[model samples]
Every structure is written in C-alpha cells, then in structure tokens.
Target: MQAQIENTAGKRLWIKLSAVAVVVALAVGGYMSMSNTHAAPDVSFTNLKGEQVSLKSMRGKVVMVNFWATSCTTCVAEMPQMVQTYNAYKDKGLDYVAVAMSYDQPNYVVNFVQTRSLPFQVTLDTQSKLADAFGDVRLTPTTFVIDKQGNIIKRYVGEPKFAELHALLDKALAT
Candidate 1:
C-alpha cells in the first residue's frame, strides 16, 4: 500500500511539473510574438535625386517612410493625403520619404509623381532591398512612422485613413 501511494504521489508531481512547463513555454512564446510584432528593421535607400537617405540620418525628425509601387492603385490613392500631411508638417520637422519598389526605370516613378504633383521626396528601390529590410512588406502601401530617436513608432500596411495617419503623426511629433 505504501509503494502504491508513493507511485501515485510521483505521478501527481510529474503532472504538476508538466503543467508548469507548458505554462512557461506558452508565456515565452507569447513574449516572443509580441516583441517580433513591434520590432521593425531599419532601412536605407537613395532618393529620386540620387541622395542617400537612411533611418539613422533622420534621427532628429519624425520620419515617415512609405513603401509604394507605381502600379498600385491604393498606393497612388494615398499620395494626396500624404502630400497634404507632409506639407502641413514639413516646417515642423516632419520628413516624408516615399520609396517606390519593383520599379526598374526611374522614369516611371518620376512620371507618376509628376502626374500626381507629389511634392515629397520619392526613391526607387530597384532590388526591393528597402521593402525586405523592413520585415515582409506584403502590401503596396506600407508606411512606417519613425520617431525622432529613429525607433519605428507605428506601421500601416494599407491605404491609411487620413485622420488615423495624422493622429499617429501628431503623436510622434508630440514625442
């Protein structure tokens, strides 16, 4: 009878340890997912005028790095709102950089910008390196709002509502 009780107690202890291990594993996984979701990588590329630009160089200003493609309707749709926002805040230390991905010829981007009258600086990502640098840019109109300290404060992956985008910009500018 004593041996039977000892065996039962050991089984109970094993079950408790297994439950604790499962909880620990779940906790670790949750933390990892949360961290990965927030941590976006820094990217660097040249502007349309052949000026080298990087997240590190815009440390003192709130930078909006927008990834776009000339063929994307949603990307083109957001240009006017972005232009308005940039024009309003440019004097207040808000910098906008639009990186055009998957466009081989700069003329395509230049033509699009000219047709739309986009005033913000535009860049061409010939190799899609900028998109790859900032995690998987699965969508055309991905925007990253970087704080003055160069940390990515917010990320939008689609045609952003102007109000929502402006709210994020205001928050970043306030910081």
Candidate 2:
C-alpha cells in the first residue's frame, strides 16, 4: 500500500498549497481596497521651473502625485519607469507631479532632476506640509492616483506595477 500512502500525502500537500494561495490572494485584494477614499488635500508647489501649481486647478484631470526622496534607492530605481508611465499618459489628460521629500536637499533634488532630465513637473516640498497633508507620508516612492473627481483612488508604496498603473490611468481618463 506504499503507492496509496504516497498518493494521500501528495493530495494533502496539494490541499495545503491551495489554501495558502487563497489566503495570499485575499490579503492582496484587501490591501488593494484599503487605500482610504479621501479627497486629495488642497496643496500647491512650485515646480522646478519656479511656476506655482495648485491641485485645485487640476481637478478636471487625472493626477498622479508621487512623493520621493533622492536618496531612497527604490525611488531612484523606479524613476525611469515612472517617467515612461507619465509620458505615456500625459497627453491623455494625466497630470503628473513628482514631489521631493523635505529632508532631501534642494541642491540634490535640482541636480537629480537636471541630470535625469525628467519630463514631468518635479516639485520640492521643502516645508513638509505637503507630506503632512498627504497622510504624513514618511515613506519613499509613495504614489497616489487621483481621479478627475478629485478622489484618491489608488495608493502605492515602494514601486508600482507599471502595467497596472497604465490600466488604471486608462480607466480614469476614459471618464
């Protein structure tokens, strides 16, 4: 009956693995739904070009506000993908603003922006007020996708899946 015992053991292992897969799927779904549906707080910042931009004025467009620090390794690693995502969506009414965390030095932010030749607007939150308004963001590469209705729809920490981001932007811009 050795074959019978081996078959039962394999079935038990398969059942355990299926259970774990279900649990992991549920956890990921929960995390995706838990981003608080808050109205994006009113904020403004001058871009690297020194022109002031207010969130209130961007109400009719899909906005992606990304908080990053120059020294955050993940943030640095994700910059090129972020730039590509913005470029792909900007013409479709996506308004992207990359904000530097206050603790990041101004000269460093400037140099990074210049060296990278980032295509979207890049602002510096020198006072940290913007971070406070955006839920006291203390993490690097925090991203929020705000729909045209001004509701914060998606919040991503670390790096986002660019393809998923494109799909979200596509859905947002269609309305």
Instruction: Please name the candidate that would achieve the greatest TM-score relative to the true structure.
Output: 2
Write one digit per residue (lDDT tens) for candidate 2, span 12-92. 999999999999999998986685467999988899998998999999999999999999999999999998888888899
Which parts of model 1 are misplaced by more than 4 Å?
A: 28-32, 35-43, 136-138
TM-score of 1: 0.78
lDDT of 1 by residue, 1-175 (tens): 9999999999999999999999999999998866553434666777777788777777889888898887888887778888889999898889988888876367888898888888788888788788888885758889988888877777888977888878887887887
How big is the positional error of residue 106 in model 1, measured in Å on the Cα after superposition?
Answer: 2.2
**lDDT at 162, model 2:** 88
Clashing pairs in 1: none
Native-vs-model 1 lDDT? 0.82
Report how far residue 43 has shifted in candidate 1, in Å.
Answer: 4.3
Superposition error at 170 for model 1 (Å): 2.7
Count of clashing pairs, candidate 1: 0
Per-residue lDDT for 150 in model 1? 77
Query: lDDT per prediction?
Result: 0.82, 0.93
Task: Report the alpha-carbon TM-score of model 2 versus the true structure.
Answer: 0.79
